[model samples]
Target chain A: MSTLISLIVSGCATGAIYALVAIGFTLLWQTSQTINFAQGEFVMLPAFFMLAGMNMGMPFWLAILVGTAISVAILGAAFKRALVDPMLRHGALPLAIATMALSIMMKEGVKEFYGAEAQPFPSLIPAIDLHFLGATISTQSLGLLAVGVAAVLALQYLLNSTSVGRQMQATAQNPNVARILGIPVERMVMYSFIINAILVSVASVLVTPLYLAKFSSGETLGLAAFIAAIVGGFNQVRGAILGGILLGITDNLAATYISTQYRSAVPLALLIAVILFRPQGLLGTAEERTV
Target chain B: MSITRKVSRLAVLTLAAGFMAAPVLAQPIHLEDVAELSGGGATVGTNFKNGADLAIAEINAKGGILGHKIEITHADSQSNPGVARALVQKALDNNPYVLLGPGYSGSVKVTESLAAKAGIANIMGGEAAELTQTGNEYVFRTSFGQQSTMPKVARYIAEEIKAKTVAVVWVNNDFGKGGRDVINAEFAKRGIKVVADLSTEAGQVDFAADVLKVKNAAPDAVFVYLNEDESARALKELKRQGVTVPLIGETTLTGQKVIDLAGGAAEGALAHVGLTTDAPIPAVQEFRKNFAAKYNYVPDHNGIKGYLAIYVIKAVTEKMGKVDPANFAKTLHGMTIRAKDEPGILMDVTYDEHGDIDRQGFLVEVKDGKQVVKTILPKMVP
Candidate 1:
């Protein structure tokens, strides 16, 4: 049916954004064995920064690139000084708290600078619809899906083929062994942070055009990403994508067939059900603990 | 004896001078704005603050209330009900003469009772119908309640738009649910059958499925009572699905954010709002210009409602001098504040004991990303 096709297209568009943010979560968790609560804030910073550039009369593409670059640079530096250094010296708790504080600071800072208006991002796609297979979909939706898939594919390739990818996997699997083998564990960790920042920023750019760019958007997106991460298996890249798409589809279908008031609740309910049934998640591997 | 008498006379003169200066030593009239300044509803709160600030500045520029300069104290509610209560209490402790608001209806409802107990008059701008019916004497709203506008909105869609079958989609929250109930009731009264009555959660980002159901219903029109963000997303998604039925709803659709988020897709979407800046009233026009100049943005109903609330206070204060909390209850009942050249989105506001406004509603259509007036419904004074 036309309704089904449209729902699928919207689901994919929304899922793509979730997948992008979820990949950042998975990458950081895999490399550092710690979650970066500030991941969503990284996404928001670029979007807001892009807004600032646009407000200053810069072109959209220029603004996006500048915003992405600034976010990556700041996040990279902050992770090195605040997260990596502190965790290496003390423990992971401090790093977690540091990221949380950074998230709060970034959220408030953006609000102060941006004046809390839900400004619209410039649409890259034309306001026209394409009818394919009995379903109508906007150019924005198609563009988001394409961009999301490409980012994931590009990330997958980088992690699989490149020397840096091998080093990252080596560091994640056995940091002590990799460090002994001269894999530059610290550098790998820092690279992971940079990549995390870049991935989140890319997601921000893609999603901002669809949703109104507001200060609190990070919170909602962060929650969705976290959910997607859990659903996909925390450290698995492909799992995250699968989880995001599933969540998006389920959300849309539930809103249509069931009660619309319970639309947001569907994902949480499914997450609970999934965790209870499959403790390791859809793609998560079981880990053995040392005595 | 003569020297002692002269010293006594000088002491008497100094005492007289000190007594005269005491009246001039009065502190400025402080107004406290307790609203969500941070978190989810910060945008709405900021709009409220901007409007209140404009009015306060203008009033102070012309020499503040009763010749005392106006001072404003703001507390961020953070969109939490508990925090809202704490903020209102904090504002009261700061010794403000009047309380402006906690903007959200749920928050306002919580603070209304507290304000009543404290004998502090609240100049509310929230439009929840239940807020006025709580029988809180000190609570007053300048904007018409959702109940007041429901019948008019329904009638406009049914009669003017000539839409027979209509679908309803609203948020589960009090604001949306209440509006939905009123609209449904009005439709029932007019013997119109609602094809689909759907409810969605607040802050929902995806509405494809919800739109699909309405599309399946094949309604001539759809009514949505959703927040600006959700409404924008829903509108965009609906358009993406090719569901092009005439959409109508509450003032939430009038927000600039909705238009911005939906872009060109929002064109032709009709909404029932109270007034617009283009109203041919000099005072409203001046207010609009002044507000736009100060904030560098067009004032929406959120701002206009707050501005009008202050003007209402000014009107009542001018007529009744130094407002007595005890008499405040009676003074507000059936009170008529004429718009009088004020370009309010709603021309004139009249309130009864229940704090509901008896004002006309304006049906506006989003044309070229702006809210253009389609038709103005005559005042339905209750």
Candidate 2:
């Protein structure tokens, strides 16, 4: 039981991180009708930026803010504006390919500058383990969980209460109708990119202490979160969160109980099952199309 | 007029033939080195290049190999197996007398056969167990084989540390898994209980769950076989979980990058250091000083192995008086050289039947941010 409890605590901590990444995928899909395949790179790049900023003698928290702001304001917004938005007009396929290219370019470019070794990120929180309910949890894990949950709640509040959120939702539902209603659909899409970048930055910064920042760090993460987005509900923000958490928990449980050698297979199996049985995902409604 | 013209034409033809023959007779010994300088394996590749460059410089200064100046042509594998293969093809086309690196196991494995077929002596630093099993005479290693390093590590864990039980955690890859198997076999021989056996995928960052599992097992000590990044992350996680079990790391932990990445968490971490930077031995101290003076940085195990590769090649080739690939293989296989016989950071360097080294590695402990050699193990038998 103690072992099970440990697994759950760690699993949930990782799940929270996955949830944030999934939210990045879901937010972009909802507003822009295109998935940013480079969502993971956005998460990885900011950690590198944060490290660089800290190395430059900036305060830790201030470095994080500056790094995250660059990822959102400059990297994310400029990328979407210059490349993604233009390609998106042609179709989702073009946009996706472009995002993948961006992902590769971003990873290789960082690798070229930083070298291929994993650079250690300074721990934002002190290394303290708290034992509760027969489980030992690190302070970093607890902090990540708290931050992730808060971000999710804040996102919910934004979507449910804010005028911009409603406008974003209107544009997502029908761009033509939303444009007729003077929603500025293009701006909503741009905002979606910026918002996703912020979420990605937060997720990456939180996890870097655990993983260490590296060129390949974003590859597995991006793929896993993309799968979570599909499994939860491709177009639903809340579903993506749930999907990410579920995948994380399942992966940890499988590693603990089944076999670490086969743990990767578990999430992939879940993805296949979800695609076959519920193509629209567990929480997603099937799209109604008129022939 | 016709006889005189014929004699002039014969003279011209003789001069042209002599000119062509002169270049071939004076052709210098060409060595090819390809390593992952641009991609994932760049850390090891960079060190390998530095060490190789230093060794080549020293050898040339003393007097070129057999009075023929040795020249090295290098290529970047980009840490990709496909790129490694292409580079091997390129090197073979150049028809170098010898080849030096291409570090990662996968890259070495992909190109080993090509080197064997081409009959080029390709000295590599990859430690995967299967690398020497292919019966490729052209393939030689300057580093420990996976099988060679683990037995000493297991002995250190069991006899020296006096750990009754050990938990094994290794990366789920050819190199890591091979080391794990050797550790298990060695532990079983010593009657130490193999309490927990765990594996993690390559490039894993989060070790909370994995470390917790090992903690739950309650082993006296933990043996880890992983790459630089994973080793650092695992060490940090172990510290975070308050698992104070003595963590015995493989040679990968001996690298400077691992210590730097793990920081204070790596204190008291014991590892089988291939070449200790702080060895009191004059040769090791000299190597450390020379490398630092040249590169403006401390040399790691990877760098030392690169230096050893060139040193060994030079030692064997000088005795031959002529650089020939087939004769070089025979010479490397037949000879057993002591630490005094050849100038290297290792003790006794000998190639076994499988082309693996028989040198015994030193056990080192991390003390005050330095790798301090504790003791050298017994000479390993072939």
Best by lDDT: 2
Inter-residue clash pairs, candidate 1: B275-B345, B284-B343
* Root-mean-square deviation of Cα positions for candidate 1 versus the true structure, in angstroms: 2.8
Q: Residue B3 deviation, candidate 1, in Å?
A: 12
* Fnat, 2 decimals, each candidate: 0.85, 0.61
Candidate 2 Cα misplacement greater than 4 A, ranges: A288-291, B1-29, B36-42, B54-87, B289-299, B336-348, B378-382
Using TM-score, give the best candidate's number.
1
lDDT of 1 by residue, B1-382 (tens): 6999999999999999999976575467778888777776676677788888887787778876666677788788887778999888888777666788888887897888877777778887677888988778788886778878888888887787788788998888767777888899999888778999998876677777788888889998899888777888888877777778888877878666678678877888888887566455576678778888998988777788777766666666655676444565567678887766333323677777787777766778898888887776767763
Where model 1 places Cα greater than 4 Å from the true spot, the runs are A88-90, A288-291, B1-23, B323-326, B340-347
Chain A TM-score, prediction 1: 0.92
Q: What TM-score is obtained by chain A of candidate 2? A: 0.95
User: Chain A TM-score per candidate?
Assistant: 0.92, 0.95
Q: Model 1 Cα displacement at A285 (Å)?
A: 1.6
- For each candidate, what's the DockQ? 0.72, 0.48
Instruction: Spell out the clash pairs found in candidate 2.
Output: none
